[model samples]
Target: MAGRGGTQGKSGDEVVERGGERDAGGGGMEGWKRKGKRSPDSSLRHVFPTPSAFPLFLHMAGSEYGRTARDVLVACLALWSVTSLVVIAVWRTSPGVRSMERCKAELHRARGRLEEARAEWGRRREELQDLLRKSAQNQTHLRRQADQLTQSLRNSDASVSRCLQGRLTYSISRYLVF
Candidate 1:
């Protein structure tokens, strides 16, 4: 088994071998080997470098930390889903929503009633105007009749005064003659 830490060259073609059991053919490094039947100390050993540390660390951490992280993420997602459902349920049953619906219904009914009242008022106004017009016409007719009656009375009074004056003059002349 190789130790955990190791160094790599800049070109990624070299690796410092760590503490590990060397194979009989002397593999180049833990998971790398030189090609062909080359000596263990040959420079050809550096042709292919060992694997990098970051991929190894990820492989190692995936066993424990990855599971815990996945569990926590799943739990958080579930909690968020449940909380959203609860909020939706509460909002649906809230009194304010119901009150708003009722108020809307009442407002609709009130508007309808107001429209009816306005229509009725319009009809009543038209009827009152018609009555006023008829009353005005009747008043004009009555005034004309009254004027005619007054003229007839004045003519009768003049005729009656003329007849009485003629009778009085005749009686006086007869008494003077006697």
Candidate 2:
């Protein structure tokens, strides 16, 4: 539901991590509770724990291999690092492309939302301008009528001056109203 990087969206159920230890809900030290070494009816007695692997490797290293534990570990790590690099290089072409594709899709979706917001703003601006123009037109008409009544009151003949004054007063009262 969120953006691509923040989506937490995976196309599959596999729990994958980029070299970081993840237990889905815990850590390796706490032991696997859902998969791999952990399963219903499984016991530690039947499982050769990963910690024993180091001792076994050390024994083999000091045996006919003529390697110290340090040398053997370095060799193993070097091999591990190199093999991991090779596998990453190969898989990068696929997963990397998929990740890029997802990013592009999210970008497109954001762009669409941005465009829709801009369009709505432009429409509202036009409507506001229209309303402002109508208000100005009404105000102009009122000002013109007020000026006409003032001019008529000053220039009227003295015979109908009272009538003109009364009519002007009536017109002024009308203009004073909204």
* Model 2 bad stretches (over 4 Å): 1-102, 149-178
Which candidate has the highest TM-score of all?
1
What would the per-residue lDDT of candidate 1 be over residues 71-167, giving only the tens digit for each residue? 7887999999999999999998899999999999999999999999999999999999999999999999999999998898888888888888888
Candidate 1 Cα misplacement greater than 4 A, ranges: 1-62, 166-178
How does residue 23 of candidate 2 score in lDDT?
Answer: 43
lDDT of 2 by residue, 1-178 (tens): 2111111213433322212334445543243344343322124324445676643443343233424655778899999999999988888778778899899999999999999999999999999999999999999999999889877866665548888788999999999995
Each model's lDDT: 0.64, 0.60
- Candidate 2 has an lDDT of 0.60
Give model 1 RMSD, 1 decimal.
12.8
